[model samples]
Target: MSSARPDIVVAIDGPSGSGKSSTSRGVASRLGLRYLDTGAQFRAVTHWMLSHDVDLADPDAIAARAAEPQLQSGTDPLQPTITVDGEDVSVAIRGEAVTAAVSPVSAVPEVRARLLDLQRRIIGDGGIVVEGRDIGSVVAPDADVKVYLTADAAARAARRAAEEGGSDLAATQASLASRDQIDSGRATAPLVLADGAVHLDSTYLSLDEVIDKIVSLVP
Candidate 1:
């Protein structure tokens, strides 16, 4: 399904701390396109789950109430926002508790389906840089430009640790590895490079370099 609008849709997929969030935002802002953080959408749901005392392992319960929460995501490239049921969950979703529980919440087929639909709706308006683990592969397969970003585990962990306020490198590495396993092994919408996507390893590349490469690829 192609958009009727003239805006270009850029799909970016990558693991955590690979600069997907920052790069997408920067690229979109510079190019005048909207930005979407699909990961934050998942975190919003996970935050709701924890708030409501829902069992993270119960797929049926998650699926049944998947549409219960009111999720609204701002696509402004300068300052994106994600709210759940009128609460600003931008910061709360990134906490240790939400981070530890997001995987299980996101792994559910029901949760993925619900969020995927929301993502598509947002993109359908056109002109968005959607970043997530499976956006290029599953969320917007026909995206105008698809980019798969990656970096060394150590680098990724270091970036994540810094953002989380001096996290243990060892623990950060283990957490990233575990998240990779869960994200890539999940039965529904596993993380995989989309066909024709431009692969980029950000381990040695500056954020500007990555953004420049993507901007160059825009059609």
Candidate 2:
């Protein structure tokens, strides 16, 4: 057994549908480390905003209510949970409405600050595999290991469409492109490959292959 305290953190950054979440969770489970989905946290907040009819275009309004909900995230790899304002929001956060508004909500500086503080606290506690757009670039810049995953846009959109079960290919492509633009262009914590981060293009790799590569990098 490794004598280390297991406090080592792995930061996985990628655009949407790049398979970072699945790979991070699997790697965490295999290595007996905790898993954190930063995207889910953003989605949880977005879910709250939508439920409360907050104007997503207004940064002040989003930031004002940043702490309105108590968001809890489950670290278990097999089953993750996200609760907003004491309500289980694992499913609700993924709705089309929330998905459509999440980019705008997440782009707000205040919302990012609120969530970034929480994310740092989560990592400070112990070992974790954190997956998000700016985890390596912003939240956990000193992470023990950083990986940037990507794939061709078409491949990424196709994979996402398949997961969504019969999604429109053209629409999915457009949505993915739009999200990429927003996530990469946002002022705060914009998505970018961190300095010295291991780059993995997952377009042709199998899930197990990707997981194996990541596991090999863990100390």
Candidate 3:
């Protein structure tokens, strides 16, 4: 613990592969605050739907069962966990299958509504770092520090491929691009930089550099 004030809340929003998870975890760990990966929450739900063989193509089908799964997100930055129906799915939710379905599942209004309430409940009283597409825009609009972290498409793709052990660079880039389009165009809380947020582009910045810059932004 750095002895910093614990009531501060940091909101980080960005497209996929922009290092939101890593950066948010680093900030929370450094400041001794809780960490919430809202993106992982969405992935957990999508994974459950896929596991249950839900008709993901039909919004009505997804909406009808959106509240069926019991989603729990552990807020520890060092060991953040997500479980669906008491099953620890921290690793399973990161699969390519869930990745492919997450956009559509997340775009469904009912799913977003359910998660938004959960996210807000987890963020109560601040002292946490929340990262997601809509964290700064909708989840924690009045966070003490709001950062819209991003990078060039090439950099983003390369980082994502590296994280996945190995992936087709061009394909990864294309997927990221497609996700950006869907996440940004959704009628619900689309991906966007919230007002008064500091835009930090990490195309050339090291992870520590990015963390340091964001940590400096704390009041």
| Descending-TM-score candidate ranking | 3, 2, 1
**Model 2, span 1-219: residue lDDT tens:** 122247889999999999998998888888888899999999999988888988888888998988887888899977888898789999887778888999999998888988999999888856889999998889998888899999999899999999889799999999999999999898989999998799999999999999889888887
lDDT (CA) for every model shown? Answer: 0.90, 0.89, 0.94
Best by TM-score: 3
Q: Give stretches of model 1 more than 4 Å off.
A: 1-5
| Count of backbone collisions within predicted model 3 | 0
Q: What's the TM-score of each model vs. the native?
A: 0.96, 0.96, 0.98
Off by over 4 Å in 3: none
| Counted clashes in each candidate structure | 0, 0, 0
Which sequence of candidate numbers ranks them by lDDT, best first? 3, 1, 2
Displacement of residue 49 (Cα, Å) in model 2 is: 0.7
lDDT of 1 by residue, 16-115 (tens): 8899999999888878888899999999999998899888788888878888888999999788999999999999999999999898889988889888
Highest lDDT: give the candidate number.
3
What's the TM for model 3?
0.98
